[model samples]
Target: MALDPAPPMLEPPAGDEVARLRRMAQRQWAARRDLERRLHDGAALRVSALTLRLGLLSHLHPDEARDLRTAVEGIQDELHLVLQELRDIAGRLYPPLLDEAGLGPALREAAGRCAVPVRIDAPDERFGPDVEGAVYFAVLGCLSDGAATPVEVVIRRQADVLRVLVSGVDACDAGTIHDGVRLLGGTVALGESPAGDALITVRIPCV
Candidate 1:
């Protein structure tokens, strides 16, 4: 009775595999920052200058050409809209607040944009950019989209580990959160809160 050939032994991930993931994460962060800089310094600046020029042209136009003034003003309005959209895109790509104010302020700003109320409990202290970015995006990803249910977010640092807890959100994509956290040598778990809300817990090591 040879019991089913004893299931094959499972092997842990190789060191090279972990290194590759770290490299990939670094590249992604660099690319996002570069793109955000270009949008802010290049495209956004150019659009803003064009809008100002159009405004000046409208003002300098003679009263005889009322049609031309109206056209210039219309163009200025469109340019303004474009500038706003560019800034929004840049913010989404990589928020400057994260770099300047650390994780707490950045998360607060994001929470302000949500339709439902979000309560946050995090320290104002700074952490490595990779650690902060991973935790910020993880929490942001778990936020309820268009749901009226309020969310509760908590962040704490213990010795060398950074822990994050999110509750009151339902239907979260745990796989996506897991992938993001795993790249930082972290773990993510899905559970239920005392109030019966879906809870997500994340732990990442940081120096």
Candidate 2:
């Protein structure tokens, strides 16, 4: 019997391709940071100021027509909501906590907003911006997968490698997470826990 032709071997990315990917990632991060800053300093501030002014107007018109006072209060409430929404969008673009505190605290803040329970165990030590950003978003993406099960996340640094393991979240889009991590010279693996829950492992060089 004739032997089947050997399968082609997969080649690692060339040095130039890796460099290109890094450049793209850097540009993306920079853009996100810039957009966040604009939202924080520009739209959010303006809306907040307007809300305050409307409050003051409402007070000034207390003796005026009741409908006028009600209109001002309504506008103030809408503006307050707008300001909050702007802040939320800016945070989602690039969290200020991620830059100020580091990965552990940032993740904790994100977990607090999740519908299901989330447990995070990460060191307070800092890593490079790229490393921390990639890991933060990767974990966040998994948590946002809308799974009903509680999630457990653990992060550890060994020598130059940073390892993250997340369990109890299945149905996460592996391709999206893989692409984000791969851009930072990391690998992502999806498996099943002993109890059959989803397990995701990520490893990246922090140096």
Candidate 3:
């Protein structure tokens, strides 16, 4: 089947969205740090409280004390899990290694989590934040499989220009990827190969 061109007037990225994303990213990072502090403090408090309870419960039947101990242990395990999950979310927000790893590693990590595999080929050089995020989501949009098909994403950089090509599964409107590419004042192209792969190309200036 032929892939239809993306909506001609695809929704542009709203200014509000850009501001909101920036604020949210900052808030989330702060919250993560605060949560880390709280976790450690809370754990300390819980241990103290549990110690008091253990003292009181020790006088009861041995079985009762054992049950109380088990419940306390369960609580500790749950808190630990919560703290770990929070850390993971914070770390992924703006990966620490983003500068060192460049866009390719981050894109690979994002694609790795997709239900369908996404193949990405990107430059080893680093790009600006807006350019990086644009490149990241340009490929990410395909992960939704809104058309119920798979996709392949290829990213390459030449001097100050970066190109992102996505093709596979159903052909999507150029409009579909255009807005995403436009975030960084880039251009996009959407097409499908004869063999049933949809393709999207995004070219952005790295300056």
Candidate 4:
């Protein structure tokens, strides 16, 4: 029998496909690494800076501390904001709470940070902490939809489960939102109701 012909070499991806993929991967990896850093190094840096600033302010003369105090005070404020932002970003990076705080409070906090009106309907008592972080990101995704449309977050407590309803936004990004939900073995379903903005619905298992 004739020897089998050698397999042809596959042509490499042309133009920017390779470059685009490389860039995309870089961005994703960088973002993941940054979040990990934030959760660890970022937290450490913020705490250290805040501690040092507070110690300095405690010893300064009122006159000196006045300007330094103001500056330090400003830094302190930014530090607090950064802490919150970092928590959100890092959680968005890799939620620390799904394994720590669960589904209810995390979502509530996400709702609180929104400029758009946010209504959080949570259980009278805490649900599984594993689920809260996922819920937090799910709500975050809904709010991020249009960035301009105000969003309402309704977290309903059902029999050992949680249902999330989001409305008043045109942009609905469910993949990211679902990833958050799935972090705790929860699932999400997306839809929109007319009249004005969009609506997104998510469901999760919480006990």
Candidate 5:
């Protein structure tokens, strides 16, 4: 299949373009970080409190406590699940490992979470936070498209540009992927691989 044309480029003076892109990237990152903080500080805190309350159940009379203990334990188990889910959501918003470690480990963790097998070739290197975030999500958007398994991701720096290549499977929301890349002043190209699988190449100015 023929690939789609690139999205319309944003026209602005060099200084204006950089400033605009910087603001856009900062806004996107801030929104994600805010949501993650809310999840951790709100729901996660509440769940912890609930678990502490369950501990107080032991103060009741032995007969009453024994009778309710089983039920309370069940509830506690469910709350634990809720906490796990909250953390997962926070991680998805902005993976802590990404900051603690780097792009390679962060992408590897993301691939491990996928149900399908993914082969990755990302050097253990760090890029600007905005640049890394854009690249990570761009590849993630492709993975979440529910395409065929055994996807391959290759990341490298080409002079002043950071490149990410994703291959395997076919079919994705090209527009969504393009928008994410474009936010970081990057370009996204969609085409067919030699093996007939989908190929997505992303180039971002990292310098």
Candidate 6:
């Protein structure tokens, strides 16, 4: 029997396609920046001010009797919890250290917040803001997946590419990470390590 002819192959994308992709990347970055600005300058600041005002209620009646003082203490405790939650939200929106310090410190701070212990090995080298932001958030999503497995993260630079490896955490937001990396003209691979640990590898060009 004669085999049918194969389907025609598609041509590679041209300059227009590349330009469209660049525009998409710029939009994504602009959205992230807007979110960070709103959280830092709007919601976070309001929450902090509210927390301070609630705390000052105790100082307003410092000479009150024991029972009143006890009531004020309870309110202060609740406000403290609310402040913690607000800080967590701010962290999720955009980690301050990620912008101020860099990727390494940001990852370490994120690891410290995880329920399971995480060991991170990252170089001091810095990349562009968009590149570092994408890499850091990818690992952050993995760590925030509510898994109890200990995590190990290693970040390094290979020539003009920045490499990030995350293992031992399940349920990472691989799809989201892939979208972000794609915008940066990068690649992401997810699989198991030799010892069966959940592994995620991301590579983004530093050009």
Which model scores highest in lDDT? 2
- The C-alpha stretches of model 1 lying farther than 4 A from their native spots are 1-16
Task: Work out the TM-score per prediction.
Answer: 0.83, 0.83, 0.58, 0.51, 0.79, 0.69
Top candidate when judged by TM-score against the true structure: 1
lDDT of 3 by residue, 64-182 (tens): 77777687667667666665665565444444344347678977877677776577777787776556655665565666555355556677777778877777645554575676666
- The Cα error of candidate 1 at residue 179, in Å, is 2.1
Sorting all predicted structures by TM-score, with the top scorer first, yields 1, 2, 5, 6, 3, 4
Per-residue lDDT of model 5, residues 112-133, tens digit only: 8788898889878778667777
Candidates' C-alpha lDDT:
0.81, 0.82, 0.62, 0.62, 0.79, 0.76
Q: CA RMSD for every model?
A: 8.4, 9.1, 11.9, 9.9, 8.7, 9.4
lDDT of 2 at 4: 97
Scored against the true structure, residue 195 in model 5 reaches a CA lDDT of 82
Report the lDDT tens digits of candidate 2 across residue range 130-206.
Answer: 77778889888888877688899999999989998888887465566787789867888888878798788888876
Worst lDDT 10-window in candidate 2:
170-179
TM-score of 4: 0.51
Task: Write model 4 residue lDDT over 1-207, tens digit each, in one string.
Answer: 899996775775554454554345445544664566667675757676776768677566676866777777777777778777766676666555433444555566666667777666665565533444446656666675546665666778789677877777544466777666554445666666665556677777555
> Candidate 1's residue-wise lDDT over 32-141, tens digit each?
86788898889888988998887787777777468888898788889988988887887777787887798889999999989889999999888866777777887788
lDDT score, residue 137, model 3? 52
Candidate 5 local lDDT, residue 95: 72
Output the better candidate (3/5) by lDDT: 5
lDDT of prediction 5: 0.79
